[model samples]
Target chain A: MRADMIPLAFRDPVHDSQSAFRRLLRALSRPGTPVSLPGPAEAPEPMGGPLAAIALTLADADCPIWLDPALSTERVRRYLHFHTNAPQLADPRAAAIALIGDAGWLPGLNGFHPGDAPYPDRSTTLILQLPALTGGSTVRLSGPGIETTTSLAPLGLPNWFWPAWHENAARYPLGVDIFLTDDRAVVGLPRSTNVEVP
Target chain B: MGIDLAFDDHGVYSFAYLDEMTKRMIRRAILKAVAVPGYQVPFGSREMPLPPGWGTGGLQVTASLLGREDMLKVIDQGADDTTNAISIRRFFARVAGVATTERTGEATVIQTRHRIPERALTEDQIIVFQQPQPEPLRRFIPHEVVARKLHAFAQYGVMYVRLYEDISRLGHVAMSSDYPVIVNGRYLASPSPIPKFDNPKLHRSRALALFGAGRERRIHAIPPFTDVKSLDFVDHPFTVQHFESCCSLCGAQDSYLDEILLDDGGRRAFVCSDTAYCAEQRGERTKS
Candidate 1:
């Protein structure tokens, strides 16, 4: 009962996790589509609700996760470790799942796994913490998910992130997929999404 | 003696007959499959209670994606009443406790073997296909390692040669079902033995199409509004099968028909392969 009050993890692990995974799945399938995430993960400072919810839902013993140094506080590490039991990797490239704690200090795409041509799926999925999902510069996206083109304004990303993402998309079957999460919402930007600034 | 109801109880097996971790793994693979849009993503295919060849891949995918609210549908060669479809549908009904439907329009997730439904699917709907063989280059390159390399380099010369040979020998490409389609103009994928007639449904489809090969241990996906091109040369363009006469039962000239032998002698009759679609058409006809 005390544990329930703390709310460090999902209240109903089975159902909550399933719901979260399904949301993540839908978001990934339809790129640039924002899906409301499950809340109340009792997240640490700077690690918003949605990312914490995602961490609890997807990460496990098998998938090694990497947290950006800025957000790698002892409390955040403890919370993730106690909840997910996923190994934390120091090197971003080695990580299957990478978390961008501060969008201002975003890393280059080369550091992470741009998986080989044959096994492009081996690349990492970046879970970036953004300021807000709406009200940012609208980036036009078109690809498998979008019927023609869709616009999403995800705030708190670096200026060069869009160009880097375009370069990443040019790689096609070899770029990393991403999840942009704010305090509440999460949107997926798959490698297949064709991003344009205008 | 009363049949032991204990085995049929809710807690006897995990929800949907698969552990959460396994489902998560499959889910991750599905995400990757959708992202790449038709590239084969290798997954740790788990053994189901059913036989290996019997829709295990589709079952695993369905089990992973399925939720309590999802309305499910299962079909084999477009028929909702086949043993394969019925067994799968019933399995989900028992384990997942989700609603099952025969009508294509009502289903949120339609797991199928060798056929896409006759009706057009909505954007929200997802189709999971039971793929016996996910790779299209296997016919030319038997070795898996070599085939992987060939796909990596985009060295599809052998596939073109094979098609060239078919045109030279047979007048036209002889492949009826399981036709190879270059997905998003990238990887060559098997369309799960669905007839060439249904291949057009795959191109820029409104619904998401997922292919699972349990035995082969591969999963692929074609996301909604994606381009899927069937392989054909300029001289011999891809063409679908058409019947001379309409369906003998429902008179559906446009629908894919199943030819049944009336007798050992030469009499044959054609009817709609999709039982539910045929029934729905009949119901509409009677209503009018």
Candidate 2:
């Protein structure tokens, strides 16, 4: 697709980003709960509305973002660069935020930065665009944000995802946080949450 | 020196005072803070009109979160009409043009210093705390490097030792405010300077709690339904302050109270520290 065909960014930058951030906050603060996200009306192929909205809301000139192979298309990169001005890094470990188009082809979680002992906040925040928020194998989540055990069944994840997530949670304050998104909604699974797969 | 026309203009400040970039930076920090639950995320703290010891941190957090639709409420020591509370409220009103309210229930975002409102906050509401010091280990270990390492390893045995020392000295925990708590069974966090009575409210709260310390250049958070356990010994459990005397005017036994000197003849009266709660109680009494 031509550069001209790339979709426009948020109509109202200030209010739209604020609204999107609030929704993201709500989703992350309540693990496994799917929350509606306000994204641009249209997005490039493979990239959905919620993913684009999150990218626009978070990515900026100061933030370094890494795009997965599936989402490394010219149209998507041009769209993100035109709007956010965030530098696309070659290494996922160095990027502050990583965008993954296909969850089934997720590169192992160990490759990404798990931050350090002192500054755990330096870790990357992965935004994975999945097929859907639900209708898959279920997993139980408990910890911060959850009053009791809550379950999530986001579709399109690999069979090894839950085991890898358990390993991620074991790192405690050092693991990368995740935001699972479909076309219109998002669900956060922070490192603090314990994901149990039966 | 001649004043520039742009500087002299009344509405020169951007919406909610901070620039969009700054807001974005702070917002990112806030998200990380929420994800970590209690771990402090350092940010670029900007200079506000208010002094550092005041509510500048809380002001910045509130400013970052504020929108045209939000209803803001500012309080100092549980009173909405106090000088600090009123000034901050008016500041937001002038800068952001958002509606300000004294009622806790009506507020979407509540900026507070040293107190959580007596009324319970709902799921939709958020509480921004003005934290003088965000690190709970600061008192125990003055060295920042060592404290960071201790936090990294989840080594909180020092804090328990301190509490034990207090118990040995005073026969009970002598801390009156600014108590240390374990957030989500992970990092140790300082819940601002709210009294022991308000400490229990932090546990599994329905509303999100965001803490900001401007001078400290740190931001932290406690998400809704998260565990916040105050430090204490197993045999001598943690307890809130109890008042033998209820409010003098509203007669509320459950609310935190403040003592007022009625005269120089050693006479004093106790009243509810939360002025809004006191007024509401009085209104209910009058109706009945």
> What pairs collide in candidate 1?
B178-B193
- The sequence of per-residue lDDT tens digits that candidate 2 reaches over residues B140-240 is 79999999999999999999999999899999998889989999888999999999899999999999999999999999999999999999988989998
**Superposed Cα deviation of residue B213, candidate 2 (Å):** 0.4
Per-candidate Cα lDDT values, in order, are: 0.87, 0.91
Docking level for model 2: medium
After best superposition, candidate 2 residue A58: deviation in angstroms? 0.9
Model 1's CAPRI class is medium
TM-score of chain B of 2: 0.95
Q: What is the lDDT of residue B110 in candidate 1?
A: 97
Q: Candidate 1, which segments miss by more than 4 Å at Cα?
A: A1-7, B1-5, B284-288
**In candidate 1, what are the lDDT values of residues A1-198, reduced to their tens digit?**
353233467887777887888888778877888999976547777788889888887788888999998789887888788888899999888888998889777657778998888789899989998889999899999988788899999888888899999999998988999999998878999899999899
